[model samples]
Target chain A: MKVYNISFQIDPDLEFQWLEWMKNNFIPSLMSTKSFTENKFYQIKVNADQSPTYTLQLYCDNIELWQAYQELQANDHLKELQYTWGEKCYYFCTEMQIVN
Target chain B: MKVYNISFQIDPDLEFQWLEWMKNNFIPSLMSTKSFTENKFYQIKVNADQSPTYTLQLYCDNIELWQAYQELQANDHLKELQYTWGEKCYYFCTEMQIVN
Candidate 1:
């Protein structure tokens, strides 16, 4: 399986709203695509700024399905997030192959 | 539980040896402490340089235990890694709180 790990640097004040939106809207929509088999969210601790870092790992069956999700759904979802959150949130994504 | 997420940027050439050492030596040694309940290693995909990025997630029952591990074992383990790998492998760590 493959994992799409996305880390978000979000304003601490908006964390509640972000988490609620993700739980009620974003995650369900993504999972509905059936491209991802499972997902996990973590609030990461970094010794940087006060901004909280969160990681969302989505497990996919293969790269092709992941790419398809990116092309068909991810772009719009990302755009929506940016539009709604403005500069309050920023993110980066990394795809990983499970070796063991 | 708390998750210690460590990401390593290693020269791709040394990946095989790194994986072997981690699987046979590092992980087992760390686990022997009984501090971490579980572990996972993933090879991350990024569009950066030729260097490969790997993330090792270690699950601890609590932050206190994690801190104790860092003080007693992690320091030495990290030192040994840097000593042996030098600039070939560099890593950064983030501790995460699982909310769900």
Candidate 2:
């Protein structure tokens, strides 16, 4: 299986609103695509030098499926988020393989 | 190698300040312990129902070293964070085994 680890930097002032939007809209839309098998959201911790953020761990059967989701649907999803968050958010994606 | 994925939810209003703290204080403190082999931070993506966050992916030689870190020093680290963020932060930790 292939796993994608995605992180986001959100505006602290609008955190609750952003969470509501994601639960009501973003997650469902992505799950509905049929390419992903499972997805989990995580709340990050703030250390002495940084504020907290959010994480989405997506599991797919293979890299091809992940690529399909990205190439076919990610842009639209990203556009929607950009409209809502504007410049208050930043993110990165990493691919992982399970060994045990 | 064993990998630990740590995610945190921080106060958005204090993000920049927090980032500076992490870069200068928290991260340095952890690295000083000399147990973690490598570490990388990622800005998470926010979906419809979630807000942006941060992730710390730490690499080590094995689970024993990770355990040493937790039992030896994690509590102090956590306490420092508590002092800074109060109730505006949350986090989760996951262990991953690399396959490739």
Candidate 3:
């Protein structure tokens, strides 16, 4: 499986909203897309900033599916996040192929 | 549970040796320590450079166990890797707490 990992740095004031939106709305919509087989969320143990860092991992069967999600659905979700949170949150993404 | 994620950028020429060493020696020794419950390896899907980027994630029950592993055995293994590969391999690490 291939994992699409998105790590975010979020303003402390918006942490609860971010978590709620991810758990209730974002993830559910992502699941509805049927591209991801599994998903996980994580909080980074070390962060220098006052803000919090989080990671969201979405696992898919192959690169093609992940690519499809990126091309077709990523922008909308990204836009939604940007519109809602603006500068309160920012993120970077990485994709990994499981070898073990 | 907690995940200790190590990401590496290794010279492509030494990729096979790195993988073999990780599978044969490093991971085995890590598991033998009884500090980690599980581990996984992955190759990042996107790269602008010629080198291959990989991630190794070790899971443990808590921060204390991970700290124990880090304080007790990490440097020795790190030294062995550096001694063997030198500048050909370099890495960064992050720790994350499972939130969902």
Candidate 4:
């Protein structure tokens, strides 16, 4: 399996409200697409900045499926996030290969 | 559950051999301590440097167990890795809360 992770650092002021929105709206909308088999969300404990950091992990059967999601759905989802939060949230994506 | 992640960026020249050592020795030794419930290894697909990066995630029921492992076993394990590989490998640690 492959894990497609999107890690985000959000403005502290919007943390609570943003988290609720993500859980109730954003993540559900993404999952509805059925491109992933499993998903996990996490708060990475690092104090690099005043903003809080979190990661959303979406697991799929293979890279091809994830690539397909990227081609078909990723841009829309990301666009929505950017359009909603703007500078309040910043993110980076990483593709990880499960070793064991 | 909590994930204690150790992320390493290793000299590309030692990638193959070091991976073999980690899969066969380091990870197993860490597991033997039984401080964690589950573990996963991954290579984050990023090309920020000449070195290749990998992560070892150890899952435990809580932070206390991980703290115990850090107090009793972590140092020795890290020392062994350092003694064996020296400047060939560099790493950082992160503690994360599973949100989903």
Candidate 5:
């Protein structure tokens, strides 16, 4: 299985807004595409950036499905997030494989 | 629920050995404590340090059990790991809360 992760760091003041957007819009919109079978939102219990940190996880069957997601949907959605949130919420993406 | 993660970076030459020790020794021993309800191992698909990176996750219901684990088991296991692998394998810890 392939797991796609978006590790985000958000200003403390924007946590509530960013979280609502993630739950109501970001996650739901991505899951609706059927490219991913499961998704979860996690708040990292650290303040390394002096802000709230989180990692949104998306699980899919293979890289092909993930690539399709990036090409067709994720690009625009991510772009919009950047434009809307600006530096208040920034993130980096990662993909992982379940090896054991 | 709470998720405890150990993100490890291992020298490529030590990958196989480290994987074996983690699977056969560390993970099983820790799970025997009944502190966590579930566990998963993920290999991050990035050669960020020219080596393999992995995240080992253990899920529990709350922080109390996790703390108990840290007190009774994790300290010893972690120390053992450091003693055994030294610089060949290094890791950092993170705890997370499932917010949605």
Candidate 6:
């Protein structure tokens, strides 16, 4: 299986709105792509720090599916989010091949 | 090899200081543990978001080495960082058994 992790650094001022949008809209739209086998989201909390961090992980059977999802992001739906979130969000994509 | 990921959500107000400390202090101490085979740090950027996010990944030959590093964190050096960073930092540890 291949695991892909995408992390977001969010502005504290827009934390609530970001979470709401991600939960209600962003994630669902990604899921609709039907390319992922498992998906999970994490809300990271810093002890006394006020910074907002969130992680989205998707598990796919292979890189092909992931590539397909990436291609779909070209659509208008994902583009809208890209513009809405703008610079307030940053993400990194890593491909992991599980070895146990 | 075993791959471990630790992510931190940092306060924007403490961004520069935090980065400096991690680069100079926390990370060096982690390296001193002498258990990790490879270590990397990533500074994540969010487009318009003001939040700060960082990730630390350690590669080990086995879980035992990882456990040793965890044990070392109990020392005074690591604790000092824990106290200094306090609530300003958040982290998650995930173990990945690479399968290619």
- Across A1-100, the per-residue lDDT of candidate 2 in tens digits comes to 6667667778777878887887789878888987789876766555645544777777788678788888888788878888878887777776655422
DockQ of 6: 0.05
Q: Which CAPRI category fits model 2?
A: incorrect
DockQ by candidate, in order: 0.87, 0.04, 0.87, 0.89, 0.95, 0.05
Off by over 4 Å in 1: A62-64
Preferred candidate (TM-score higher): 1 or 2: 1
**lDDT comparison, 2 vs 5, better candidate:** 5
- Candidate 6 on A8-27: residue-level lDDT in tens? 77888888998889888887
User: Candidate 4 clashing pairs?
Assistant: none
Of the candidates numbered 3 and 5, which has the greater TM-score value? 5
- Tens digit of per-residue lDDT, candidate 2, span B1-100: 6666767778787878777887889878888987789877766555546544777777788677778998988888878888887877777776654422
Flag regions of model 6 displaced more than 4 Å: A72-78, B1-100
Clashing residue pairs, backbone N/CA/C < 3 A, model 5: none
User: Highest DockQ among the candidates is held by which one?
Assistant: 5
- Evaluate model 4 with DockQ and give the value: 0.89
Identify the CAPRI category of the predicted complex in candidate 5.
Answer: high
Ranked by TM-score, the better of candidates 4 and 6 is: 4
User: In candidate 3 chain B, what residue range of length 10 has the lowest lDDT sum?
Assistant: B44-53
**Per-residue alpha-carbon lDDT of candidate 5 for residues B1-100, written as tens digits (9 for 90 to 100):** 9998999999899899899999999888878899999998999987556689999989999678888998878878789889999999989999899996
Q: Supply fnat for every model shown.
A: 0.95, 0.00, 1.00, 1.00, 1.00, 0.00
Looking at model 1, residue A56 earns an lDDT score of 88
Return the DockQ of model 5: 0.95
For every model shown, what is its TM-score relative to the native structure?
Answer: 0.90, 0.52, 0.90, 0.93, 0.94, 0.49
CA lDDT of B21 in candidate 2? 85
TM-score of chain B of 2: 0.85
